[model samples]
Target: MAQITKAGLTFPIMNSGNRHGEVSGEPLPILMRYWRARRNPRDIPALPQTVRRATGLTQQDVAYLAGVSVRWYRQLENGVAADYSADLLDRVATALDLSPAERATLYLRAVGRPPTPYSPLQEDTAECWDQDLLQLFVDNQEPMPSYATDLSWNVVAHNLTLRRWFPWAAHGANLMRWVFLEPEARQHLVNWESDWARPFLGQLRYERAHHPANAALAQLERAILAGSQDARELWHRREVVEHSHGAVRRLRLPYHQGQEVTVRMVTVRPLRTVALCVNLLVECANPGGPSAS
Candidate 1:
């Protein structure tokens, strides 16, 4: 864990943790240099004036709410400003009353990073409607279990089939919370040591790095940390997983015989950039043989 300095920036060199057993690192200053040299936060799109009009707030009023000077806020909204900290962006997001998805976008923009762009989620504010749509989609899967989840894994929708397959899904329906909080599910995770914690921990780390002020997300994170040493250790790693695609595992599933269900989770990123993860449970057509890892 030795820290090195270069060009007034600090970085760490660490072990490879692999067969190569090599130590490598990136200089924080260098990454910043590249980011600053090639990046521009001004590229972040401005909040719409119409949205502001709807709020009945003028530019100065909005700036007041955001705790920034009128000129500075104007420059930001005008796309003439560059570089904003997460805290500052959070303040602006609060002023706008942006949804979690919109707030995340603002944070990315403030840091001179472009958000992942995709289509919007279906337009529906009614929770019941969202859940209904989700249920309908997953219900058709039948023996192949699937569930619909919001960005944070709040159980917006799930079929009875999935709920029956994973009883824990019925208990509150928040994926992040349930994964860390459920006693039975916790033990069922084969690698509660790492795999079980890494994905969600990494996802939260990513969210916090940008929207660090989210009280609800922060509270949930602290709660999770309070429960598991593994969660606490993984949180400190500060890694991020986009969860858009690649290998995914269900550590416990009745269909998979409580063995890890190594399934490929497909993600449909709506224009809002919130991930819609679909877990396709592909098991052997024949049943009753020794379960595959």
Candidate 2:
């Protein structure tokens, strides 16, 4: 008699004294069976259903909730080897009503354990960061300003050079907030209107449009609109910035006697989470500003 989860399986899951963090077979078969059982809820246990169709989600329902196509979700349930993003998996787990332990197990099976040890007590929405990969970028970009941002444009990870270049980054998280509301930003960023604020404000607007339901982003937008009269006026311009890659901008670095320097922004997305962005600022040798002093 095979069980999806064996009896007496405690936290820090082990397979009958096997090595810690080791998993047997793939994880989706269990989910596939779970989905099947949901269609016939009597097979598992009794549960009240408002609608007569079923108690839990159908494949289409899961696809809708997780923002995937039903065909894709069907393949996933059928144990297809697909490179799904962490965010997508979490969304599916939420739709599946998976416990923290089950979520952790699924993650373990899909991507192996994250750089950080698996924590079964984590919340359903929690994401597992590849700390080593984040650290690798930070370490490799020594003396060069590079940082990673989440969906909210918050500086989730950064290198020493980033902190050195913009001291505000040391404590002032939420890069969007800094760009919009921080006084220090206007001082450091050259041409506070055309060069800095317009582009960033456009990006904020674009993100809000893309993720209208995101409360954090909505709150950030409201705060920016309330805090800066400039933001309000520019936001009405109705511009949208899709991406900033290869975009040249000018700023006053903390060092070099606060000299105006030209930098180009290059953006990359990690495989673990496509929504997260990593930006590396490369300074141009020739400062192309009007007063390239």
Candidate 3:
């Protein structure tokens, strides 16, 4: 009688430990059957194209590093074919220079791990110096309610209680976004047709000339055109202004405050990477006040 056990065991007498422990050929057949099923590329998981965009690497580059053909990698990205062996998948992960989160995604897709969410880093990330510089403006209480802003004036951070005065401060959420898109800005602005809009339009043109390949800047330009016809016209004029400094503008607080405030705007280039504007809002000691030097 043949002994009943895993793998092919031909035996007349059942031995407890006949050969050194090793997987028998019987298990190999079953393993091959499961392996064949697992090798289908379409059945396995793969990282999304969005993930690739976030990682900032092209598929061709990733494939070359992974030692796989570019066509095969594209097929993997598209979930077209499955030949992802554990070892091969490991090579691919390393080639992509994946973060821990990204590596985990690939692992799950290859093996039977649960799907997890991965957040990719954006390219136009502001540096720590930018934050520090922005904070300096906020902490200095010259009663001048000072704040710093980025090119789009997203108000990455601000200390001014001016959030109360200029409702635009909130809209300053994204400087370029507010300038070109917001309807309230277009209607309520004192000089939407000329002064205020002109300089910003000029600065934007200068920025375009300097950074034509800058994706964030390009996206902003696109948004402006998409958001408003006026913005489109302003862009076409090609007015270019270097946002260094000049005269100040009087901004009225929203309907609630109704107080007209004189704000001196100064641009400081502490770093070459980011252009910063420090806005110092003037307050009055008397009813009709003179400007603070």
Candidate 4:
């Protein structure tokens, strides 16, 4: 009698009694069939070959787009590089113009783990805002600078007072874009590096992870990275943090001229909606004072 061990179970071999109740001519177990199929020569393609066939991009093009040297990219495609970081793979995926599914496939083939999936929420911009809630937020805040943002951080609504104060919080202006791309933001935000840029980027990273399929968000990310070297470096760091509330900061308000204003920034979420959040910036009593909101 002969025996074989599979999945920690012992089974009789073909020469022995058939444990699977097969009459001598029956097919192998499903697991064995799958194993055999995986060994088929026609089923697998080299990573370099796949990239060539899938994107029709030259090695030099991929290297330049991914911010890697041509020598390194060639080695990676040829499977000679023993180690590659996920960050590098991500850049390669972006350079190749891969879809979410194709990106997952690339990760699986290269690293043996499927990349995180991105299933963007179906909520449209029109459905993201509630006029009643926006009115309530604006009305209740009175003189405070308050505004609402959708999931993509687009300023959906704001009170007249906020516009009077910042003037740049235009309707539909993306917060990330305004902060990174707008020159006025750099001038106004006193602690642009610590208070605004890094924290805001962490929040954007969280959003990108959760909503990877969002085309607009992806485009915005690309634009920011291309426009700012600092932003690109921070993005590659892969640091993630929650959007903070009740943080106080000094701003060189255009309205206030050279003097800085201490303001307490608070973020709030309305009932039954994950898409809308309200941010309130209330003036502090004294310069460099603790948050009052």
Q: Which residue pairs does candidate 2 place in steric collision?
A: none
Residue ranges of candidate 4 with Cα displaced over 4 Å: 1-127, 286-293
Candidate 4 residue lDDT tens string, 1-293: 33446677554333112344433421123222332233322222212234334324456656765678989776665434245676677776655545566566555544545665432235343344558868786768878888887777777788888888767776557778778767778888887877788888888888788777675566557656644556877777787867768778878886887688888788988766676788998787655543222
On residues 1-293, what C-alpha lDDT tens digit does candidate 3 reach at each position?
23334446332211112145322232222222232333322212132234323323455655654567988766555333354665455455544434455555554443434223321112334433447756765767544566666555556555547565555665537766666656667544445557567778788778778766554455456445544556666668878887736445555446536555555565565554554566565543322544222
RMSD (Å) per prediction: 20.3, 15.2, 16.3, 15.8
> Which candidate achieves the best lDDT against the true structure?
2
C-alpha TM-scores of all predictions = 0.48, 0.55, 0.49, 0.56
lDDT tens per residue, model 2, 1-293: 12344344322222221256445553555544564456443221112234555655567656754557989877766555567676666666655545567766666554555323322112224555776778787769887899988777777788898887877777738787787766778878888788778888888888778876665565567556645668878889999997688877888766757888888888998675545788998888645555221
Name the lDDT value of residue 3 in candidate 3.
Answer: 31
The CA lDDT at 182 in model 3 is 64
Better of 1 and 2 by TM-score: 2
Task: Rate residue 36 of model 1 by lDDT.
Answer: 29
Order the numbered candidates by TM-score, best leading: 4, 2, 3, 1
Query: Per-residue lDDT tens digits of candidate 1, residues 1-293?
Result: 45667767455533222235443434222332332233222222222334224323455655655568988776665434356665565566555545566555454434434333321132222322344655677788776667666545666556676677677677656778677756666656655546557877887777666555445455456546644455766777777966635444444666557665544455544343343455544433322333222
- Candidates' C-alpha lDDT: 0.53, 0.65, 0.51, 0.63
Off by over 4 Å in 2: 1-128, 287-293
Off by over 4 Å in 3: 1-133, 167-172, 271-273, 282-293
